[model samples]
Target: MGYLKNIAIAVLALSLFTFVVLFGQLPALRKTPLGTLQRALCLHLPNGLRSVDSRVTGGNITSKSRRLGQYLFYEQNPVVLILFLFLLTGSAALFLWNALHRLPMSLIVPLPIVLIPPYWFTYLCATDTDHYITPANHQDRLRDYPYDHVLFRPGAICKTCNLVKPARSKHCSLCGHCVAKCDHHCPWVNNCLGRGNYSFFLALLLTLGVLQLYGAYLSYWILKPYLVTDATRSLPWREYLPELGDAMVEAVNMGGLSIAGVGLLAASTAALPLGLFAYHCYLIWAGMTTNETQKWADWRDDIADGGVFKTSREALLSHSRPRSPEGANGAASTGLAVHLGVTEEEPQVRWPISSAQVIVRTNDGRPPRGQETLWTQIWSLSDVDNLYDLGGWDNLMEVLNGR
Candidate 1:
């Protein structure tokens, strides 16, 4: 009973941490109560502690911890990847050691099939470098996706990589390279999930969910007798509640942590990967990436501020490209900060849909200088076209094909 109580408490704590860590950065969730808590934990709390440390210890404590924090979190490291694999392997080993012998051959036969894919896919996701944009492949990366004229534009250059920021590409500071078709950097794999390995990341999520569910099932198989009672459906609600509680306690006492605890852990946490997979699926359907969603969210917020202007690409192309954005330093009036390339030209790309819509963010929440007639103020995301979305099926193929 004490062991069960401890396990419950541990899982509850872990669930909260996982919720904050995984869902904190999502644009939709950032304004929720969870988001507020996340900011307090990841931002305000750390700053307050660091400030106190600086006063008490002449910044010595925080200075050292900050460097360690930078290395562990801000830099590209295998700490998270190792921890994920270690936990995954340890949980499976613990569950199998206790429950495998009790499982039937029918159930035992599928274990290898279910178990091997997560490891294989994780290897693929972690090691893939084909998505990394280099001078040798810069032109090729550029031709993969056409600039949507809304979210992505030509002429933006990454100061670090000194490479033209390709449509749908993003520079990952941790990886120290621009990634083509960049979604988001995933610490769980210690790599950027982009063109080359995004499909494998999806596979890893799927196999991981399946593996957890199957492990939980095997544990259930071993503890089924203790988990059930002769109490009938005719039992009152109060009686049934007590019966169910008693049955679960008996099951835990019989199976201990290996069977009951791992089972509960696996069953409860299976939603994490599956829910993430579903979110990714929705992104594909909408023709966006995790990185792009953040960008689009900023645009939406700016539009709400009446700071976003739309025009035809032809109208903008008619005028000479400016060496720099007119109000580069002044784009702070809008709630969002816009990054526009200085004196960039649109590159020719092979794509089914070519968009002519162009959008610009102004520092004054007004139209660009001497171009009032050519611009139209916009207020909604539906007005924007996502050229990357070729419908859900095509988007999935694009990911699978690594394009």
Candidate 2:
């Protein structure tokens, strides 16, 4: 029982740590206590360890570990995807093998329904390559989303891919290509969850949560005979708590490792996927990707420091620059130019909603030199426009259509 308690506590601690690691850097939580903890863990702790390692081992340990970390994270590998499948399938098999016979027909009938989608969706997410932006499809990908002139703007090219970065698209070093409508490269799927497979990723998260919850319910059902007692309710208020604890331990002991241990893990770690799904829902609602959220957070920080400036495209154009031919010059060449440091070829996207406002972040916390009259310091994000957000409903519909 003590060992079971220890396992539960360990599982819970791991789940919480995973939650903080995954969510702490998000724009919505980057300023919160969770963010502080994440900085301490991911940033401060690594730096401190490097310092110690430098002193003790002449940086050899740090070099080796850094290489390993880089390979694990930066290289395109199936390690995480394999590990995820192993854990998921192993746990489901353990739970069902032990708890299936004892459960009622109602529970037994729903097991396959609950369990199958994660595997199906995970395969879709993992094996999907259609989202990977290639030279062949690069031209078409450019028309995917209009530049917001904030997080993403015209004329930015991915040096690695040697191609113009489409709006809302990003080059993934691990994936070895630019991904269309890039959200983030998810290691769990060994793929970039973007235009083609992002919807599948969403379904995987939802179904994974349902599977874990169902497994947890089955565990509870199997142990119900032992957990239930007249004494649990009959006992006095103060005594009832301890009695409930004893009953839980007894139930766990009765179920043993296959049922109890797997169930504990399922219940404890269920929040990771479910919580991630909720966050993605928010992202869709706001019409931003995981990549865009971080970009927005950086913009938010710059705005806070008064380094960000805003102006209309018309105003910038009127103040300066002559237009070149549409094909030879980029989209911004007509609206902005060399003065703004963006003169590369941009996609001639036929977007429904065009953004007039252009934003820039200055290192000096002032407007560009000599263009002071045209620029205005933007103090709030509300003053800016998000071109992708056609309200939440439309955004959701676009996501549902796998756009």
Candidate 3:
């Protein structure tokens, strides 16, 4: 029953996640103009497969055929749908299986590969003005504005960096820098997925899928192949010396037998990446972000504020509800103490969730020293728990100090 319950949960989670990626997020991501780099990437594909080719290239039903093809690939390609389901589910299974094996988070590298689907989808879905504006057009637009004060440029603007955001660019508050064409923050990859290393991400995902799928395939009726092969080699020895030829010895031989294993491995490795890229191509046409497609609803808006949609502060407050101590379990007590460790001693952290402000105070009730990390300031001001526990405090120390 326990095993069955786990399996059921796994299936449900994969199904829910996949549904959101295909339906919810793709549509909104398509609004951005295509960038030159993205365009170049698309152009490298076969003419028959390119998104705009049906419109640009010549054919017998040139216009009509192109439109039909476009609709099929973008709106309703059966292969794409099937492949999407397989890849998404397979990727999830692989991740979960590895997680269950007690693998360390740092060593479980397959997640980087699985993470590619969403990032690629996000990139393909981006249709902002950055891709639409050309150098010539920028020159024309600049002709009308004062040269010194003109801030709006061709690319997306990075508000924090105070510079033009390139294709796939994103701002990371922790890093205090803007990434060009950012994919996502990946702890497993231990690097930001951006324009520079996107292809690598794709490669990694495909490789992971291959490795995982192969393992899955090996689990079903796998013993049969080994059993039959082992029987053939051991018959003479077993017949001659039944006492010595034990089941254990046969089992070891069977495990070691190579028997077309390399071929299977090769096929899996090749198929995994090819399959991912192909599915991603379809997602691009659909114009969806992985997060958007899976949920249809705003995750940031739906959950606690610090998630995908909400700003750091909004997420902290929106999700904060007083934890109940009535249960009185030992494990629960320990968890509660850890969660409230920084906050319990502080009082100044009680602030409105919507505000981007922080209340500064010292334990001794004196002003904090200058040149502190936001974390240090917050810790000094109030006795907060983890920095994430509150809304008004941007730095962790504010959360710890509760100021």
Give lDDT tens digits, candidate 3, residues 199-223.
4555555555555454444432233
Off-target runs (Cα >4 Å) in candidate 3 are 1-159, 225-279, 283-403
TM agreement with the true structure for every prediction: 0.88, 0.91, 0.28
> Which of candidates 1 and 3 is the stronger one according to TM-score?
1
Q: How many backbone clashes does every candidate have?
A: 1, 1, 43
The list of candidate 1 runs beyond 4 A from truth reads 1-13, 55-61, 231-235, 319-345
User: What C-alpha lDDT do the candidate models reach, one value each?
Assistant: 0.82, 0.82, 0.37
* Model 3 lDDT, residue 68, Cα: 72
lDDT of 2 by residue, 288-385 (tens): 88888878878888899999988877666555544422223233444445534333333467566767778888899988766676689989888889
Candidate 1: residue 382 Cα off by (Å): 1.5
On the 0 to 100 scale, the lDDT of residue 171 in model 3 is 61
> What would the per-residue lDDT of candidate 1 be over residues 1-403, giving only the tens digit for each residue?
4555677688888888888877886888888998888888889998999889989998999989989878777899999999999999998898888787788899989989999999999999999999999999998888888877677867789999998899989999999999998998888999999988999999999999999998888888888887666772467878886676677788888988899889998988998998789988889888899899999889988988889888775555444333335333233322122233322355668777777787888889988766676679988988888888899898878877876
Q: Quote the lDDT for 21 in model 3.
A: 39
Q: Any idea what lDDT model 2 has? A: 0.82
